[model samples]
Target: MNKIKPGDIVVITHNTLPRLGVVLKVHKREDPTKDIARVHLAKHNKAYNFLISDMEKIIDKNT
Candidate 1:
């Protein structure tokens, strides 16, 4: 998959209960680095951070 950058919109597709969020940062998906993606999501009504791989970029195909 192409590498995603900050500001990209991502959606969490895992967990028994799924949610959506945005990417605040990007990191290599391996050792040597610790920080993953920082997502701002709205679960029920509150927003929070989420991982990169844990979510998918929401591509606006309507453009």
Candidate 2:
């Protein structure tokens, strides 16, 4: 998997549904699995912290 960074787009499974969001910040820890990311959900207009491992980075096809 690619390393998730701020401004990257990602998808997270919420309540069994996939939600897309932009990464606002990433809090890295000594243990990579413990890393967390603050993502802004445009559809919901809210930001939430989610475990990095729980989210998948969305690659831009145009890039």
Candidate 3:
């Protein structure tokens, strides 16, 4: 998987349904494998926290 960063569009799966969001912040935990991310969802106008592994970057369809 590619490294995620702020401003990247990602798909978050832990929520009620898979949703698209923009990464806001990344918090690295003591265990490197358990890094967390804060994402902003435009549709809901809200932000949520999730594990980095639970999010996948969105591939540009136009490319």
Candidate 4:
């Protein structure tokens, strides 16, 4: 998985139905591998916190 950063698009993979969101912020933990990300779901118009491990970054080839 690629490193998740603010503005990067990501998918919440922990749910039964994956939801797409844009990363807003990343909170680093003592263990770098356990970072948490703040993602904003446009559809829901709300922000949620999720473990980086539970999300998959989406790479845009058009970029």
What are the lDDT figures for the candidates, one per model? Answer: 0.61, 0.88, 0.86, 0.87
TM-score, prediction 2: 0.86
What 10-residue stretch in candidate 2 is worst by lDDT? 54-63
Model 1 alpha-carbon miss at residue 12, Å: 0.9
lDDT tens digits, residues 1-63, model 4?
576778888889997989999989999999977899999998899999999999988854236
**Alpha-carbon RMSD of each model:** 3.8, 2.1, 2.8, 2.0
lDDT of 3 at 9: 89
Pairs that collide, model 1:
none
What's each prediction's TM-score?
0.59, 0.86, 0.82, 0.86
Candidate 3: what lDDT?
0.86
Q: Write the per-residue lDDT of candidate 1 for residues 13-37, one digit (tens) a residue.
A: 7687767666665666556234476
Please identify model 3 stretches exceeding 4 Å from their true place: 59-63
Better of 2 and 4 by lDDT: 2
